[model samples]
Target: MFAADAASRALGIRLLASGPGSATAAVVVTETMLNGQGSTHGGHVFLLADTAFAVACNAAFSPTVAAAASITFLAPTGLGDELVAEAVERVRQGRSGICDVTVRCGDRVVAEFRGNSREVHPRAQRPE
Candidate 1:
């Protein structure tokens, strides 16, 4: 999707999955994205996971909206480190869904996130 691409380019993200529900996406860590200690910023990880969640939820149902999200940082990542974010749909309730996403570098788990999204009715589908 163009939104995904634009978000990626503007935020310096990379697509690892070809489609929405795929599993993972590669994220390149740059110095600009790192903190003072040379580790990736928490916001970067959150954005990566959030983007993946958006794609996953939207692919299943269009116009999906994020209801809630929680992220946990387990480890640190640095510049030049290629991170992989994997998102899995955990549950679906009518027009809403929950997803679990994990970010890793090789065998190290860097972060994890849980997100919820809701599908909004299209203009044509709205009740008149």
Candidate 2:
């Protein structure tokens, strides 16, 4: 799934790790990812987290998509900060799942993201 993520790939999001129910990704803050205030845009931060969430949710082998997602910005970051997002499945029941992601630059927490997922194709059973 990461290999086919065109939007995230176009924005320079790279997979750091992926497993059954977890994933990590990194993105370097570039000039293009900044806002008018010289800080990295919130959208970009959420994108980083979302990318990791996508990888984690799909790691089950069954295709899934975000049913809902929300992000909270904890700190500001600027160009050259390599933001890393780590996602882990929080809970899974029936056809729904929850995942939490933490975005960090060095040791500072930059943002937090939570994604709710639903399987898009049920025929593909999620691998345990």
Candidate 3:
């Protein structure tokens, strides 16, 4: 997944670290990510946080996918800003999981995200 995350790669996002139930990702805002308002796009910010949440949830679980997610933007960032997203697993039970991700620029939080994941059986992907 990391080798071929085309969307994240296109946005210059890098997975800095990941482990069971935790992950961190980073991205440097560029001109292409700016919106017409001249600030970073909210979608890009959500993507970064969502990526981190995905990694953390899938770290120990096999082929987990997000069932739902929501984000609240706290601040806006400009081009050249360095953003970091960190995800932590809040709960995982019986194929259901919850994760929280925080997006920040330095010490200031830029956004908060929560993701709900449901684990899929590998067998489900096989054609009958």
Supply the global lDDT for candidate 2.
Answer: 0.94
lDDT of 1 by residue, 1-128 (tens): 53556866687676667455445677789878998888999998898888778777776567777899999999998989988888888888788888999899899999999998888887685566
What is each predicted model's overall lDDT from 0 to 1? Answer: 0.80, 0.94, 0.93
Q: Which stretches of candidate 2 lie over 4 Å from their true place?
A: 122-128
Q: Give the Å shift of residue 26 in candidate 3.
A: 0.5
TM-score of each: 0.86, 0.93, 0.94
114, model 1: CA deviation in Å? 0.2
Q: Is candidate 2 or candidate 3 better by TM-score?
A: 3
TM-score of 3: 0.94
Q: After superposition, how far is residue 40 of candidate 2 from its true place, in Å?
A: 0.3
Cα deviation in Å at residue 61, candidate 3? 1.3
The candidate that wins on lDDT is 2
Off by over 4 Å in 3: 124-128
Which of the predicted structures, 2 or 3, would earn the higher lDDT when compared with the native?
Answer: 2
The deviation in Å at residue 17 for candidate 2 is 0.2
